[model samples]
Each structure stands twice: as C-alpha cells, then as structure tokens.
Target: MKKLFLITITLLTTLTINAQKVYSTDQSYKADVKVYVVDQEYQADLLVFKVNADYKAKGNEGKWFFTDAEYKAVKKIYFTDAAYKADLKVFFVDSEYKSGWKDKSKQHFMY
Candidate 1:
C-alpha cells in the first residue's frame, strides 16, 4: 500500500512539473522563452489558450495558466515585438480545445 501511495504521489508531481504554468517577465534576460504574438493564426508556431486556473494548465499542449509569481510557474516568458527575436511565435485562441502546437519543430521551446 505504501509503494502504491508513493507511486501515485510521484506521478502527480511529474504531471504538475510538466504543466503549462507560465509567468510573463518584463526582462528578456530573466525569461526562459522569448515569445512573439503573431497577428494571424497561420503565422503562429503555437496556438495558446489562457486558462483561469493552474490545474487546467495541463501538458505542453499550449493551455497556459499565467501565474502571479515567477516561482509558481514552470516557465518564464518575455514577449518580444519582433518575431525574429522570439524563440516561439504564438497566436491566442478563444477555446482551450484549439490550443496546440502548429509547428512541431518549435515545440521544444515550451519544454
């Protein structure tokens, strides 16, 4: 029973660590990923949806929860004006179901 409990706890911890909890940083040097918001969805490498709760931010599937503090986030992102300066280019989607990687090549940036 103790082994089962430990396994369950470890699984939950791993899932939480892999969750898309992001913090927006003002300084680019402090950011883990430099992001650019594309005007059109076609121009984006990823389609992102902002979730209200952290628990809803699951996986690296682009469902992001903006954390109040940087310590609470899995990743820190800085928004760049130029697309060329960004590590990832994203487009905000209205629905969570629409959130996912448009370009699989740039998927590693979130991880």
Candidate 2:
C-alpha cells in the first residue's frame, strides 16, 4: 500500500508539471480564453507563455499563428488594427479553461 501511494503521487506530480498550457491562436475561435481590456488595447492572459500587446496582429488562429515577439508572457496578444479599434481577446490558461476544451477533441499528431 505504501509503495503504491508513493508511486501514485510521483505520477501525478509529473503530469502536473508537464501539463501543456493549451489555447487556440485564433480569437474568433475563442478557446476558453480570458479576455482583458486595458487602455484601448486587448490582451490574452495565456499560461506557460509571456505575450505582448503592443500591436494588432493580422491573423488570430492556428498553431503557427501570431506569437508575441516576447514569448515570456502568455499565449498571444494584440491591440487594435486602426480599422478595428476596440478591446481584443486575451486567451489564458486556467483551471476552468483547462476543462473547457478538454472534452472537445485532441488533434491527431502526425510526425
């Protein structure tokens, strides 16, 4: 029983550390993201990442989508692209978000 308990704890710890901070790079998609508005700018509070909200990016979706030049913050970020001046979406990683898309479906990995 003692051995089993220790092993279980170890496994759980490992999973928690490596759990991917997942989110959609597209704002239109809205992948359980936390939207924020600040001083005529929008930011996504993504986890496992550091994002920048200095300018409005062109695209807002996909894996290889727009990542903040500063990758130390969150998932992605954007301000207002002149024509579209308004608060943008700020996608972040949270316990609530974790379960949001958990039931959706995993993308097939082909490598």
What C-alpha lDDT do the candidate models reach, one value each? 0.95, 0.31
Q: Give the TM-scores of the predictions, in the order they appear.
A: 0.93, 0.23
Model 1: which ten-residue window has the lowest total lDDT? 102-111
> Which candidate number would show the highest lDDT if scored against the true structure?
1
Which candidate has the highest TM-score of all?
Answer: 1
Model 2 segments more than 4 A misplaced: 1-24, 40-111
Error of 2 at 110 (Å): 29
Clashing pairs in 1: none
Clashes of each: 0, 14
User: What are the C-alpha RMSDs, in order, of all predicted structures?
Assistant: 1.2, 12.7
TM-score of 1: 0.93
